[model samples]
Target: MNTQPATRPAFQDRHILVTGAASGIGAAVARQLLAQGARVSAVDLDETGLQRLHAQAPHRAASSRLEDASGHLWTARLDVRDSAQVEQVVAKAQAALGPLDGLASVAGILEMGEVVDLDDAQWQHCFDVNATGVFHVCRAVARRLRERRAGAIVTVSSNAAATPRAGMAAYAASKAAVTQFSRCLGLELAPYGIRVNIVSPGSTDTAMQQAMWAQGSSRAAVIQGDPSRWRLGIPLDKIATPEEIAAAVLFLLSDQASHITLHDLRVDGGATLDQG
Candidate 1:
């Protein structure tokens, strides 16, 4: 049994790049890492949200705040799906923050509609953002980690990947792909001492959740009727909060879980169990 101080900072000098850092789970993870004295680089397409994140830590604000615990964090306004942009940003981040120590892939989208009614463009867009976006960031960061012989990666997946829902076909499938990709990455990267893991969250009470609630309820009679049993409803009896999901990511990235890799850690408040 290994015992250490309960309140020690396990990631004091680690550099972490978090996508979707503008809101929801990504934002929470960034904040948690900062509080633990880790160097953190955050990116999102929402420049306004990035500004707000910086504003929250003005005392520690600097151009590369993500790399410098005492200075401002780095915020990039780039879409994860853009491979060129992702490569450029990763290089810049490593140059500014030092080598890439970790990556948290949290940028994704969920579009709910019957698959037959969904357009090809919509399906492509979701996969491009969710699945391909992950590929871009992971490939870029893992390359550096492999060269250095150390690093960790945690991707945000979804419970929908395991339990199919009526209106979440595209979203579920995208996450399923992400899960498989992460597993493959784990095996391929193990030789270089890199660990890859996935965190699959159920409906969390983020802005995304609110949007989903509205979408399903817009047709209350059609969606909530006895025939459907409101099967698509969040299975936890209530939605989780973003912080809950972030905690799981923090654990997977920390030294406490150094031996774990290539697995899906679900933080859905027993939502999947209820459905099962």
Candidate 2:
């Protein structure tokens, strides 16, 4: 409800591809991009959430909308685990919205369990979505950006990737892979004038965080530490909204961070004490 539009609409006519755009951090990024005048190719595994996002059109002029769109918004049902599907989607999105100005790789999953208790399928699923999925999309888009010789990318990771979490081994490990991968990618793409950065967020108020509550964790416990599980609470005494995380992401993608690359920005409200 506090989704404030930016005072300056700086990205007019720019194209951006947002994964996990159906909800949470991804959804927040998509809305703000539209508000800043970017054309967004919003893809997610959830078709319904995409439809709902398509209905919110105040960010842009109504006349800019297509028959199935709400101005500067294009929706696609994407499962990033499929490399082939990722390639096709990126191609079609560019054809529809023009060359991509940037990308926000926010599609990811969280599966918590101790290392020894983690099943093969569970471990693989986490890496598939959180790590390999990022690889697929980034490769698809980077190939284009390399030739065009410009653009930026921001991959969403988790703060747990920097700090240890007793029951989040799978999720944390996958996000760690994402963090390092983005750094390596930034290095390789630097000469081409493309920027790649990572945004690692702590506890945030979203359906994903609510699901942890459904599993019996209390909000107070999340904000006040959980020693038994080796989890640190937010020092700020509150959970972040997806929009806050999105702001960090957009900054890195914007010209404001033009000189920054291969950096991992933590938006954890001091939860990890600035851990790497």
Clashes of each: 7, 0
lDDT of 2 by residue, 1-276 (tens): 779875767778889999999899999999999888899999999988887778774544444332234468888889999999999999989877889889999999989778899999999999999999999999999999999999999999989898988888999999999999999999999999999999999999999899988888978989999888777888899999999999999999998999999999999899999977
Clashes of 2: 0
- RMSD for each model, in Å, please? 4.0, 4.2
C-alpha TM-scores of all predictions: 0.89, 0.93
**Model 2 pairs whose backbones collide:** none
Q: Evaluate residue 276 in candidate 1 and report its C-alpha lDDT on the 0 to 100 scale.
A: 22
Number of the top candidate by TM-score? Answer: 2
**What would the per-residue lDDT of candidate 1 be over residues 130-242, giving only the tens digit for each residue?**
89999999999998899999989999999788887777788989999999999999999998888999999976778887786676553243222233533454334556778
Q: After superposition, how far is residue 167 of candidate 1 from its true place, in Å?
A: 1.1
lDDT for each candidate structure: 0.82, 0.90
| Top candidate, metric lDDT | 2
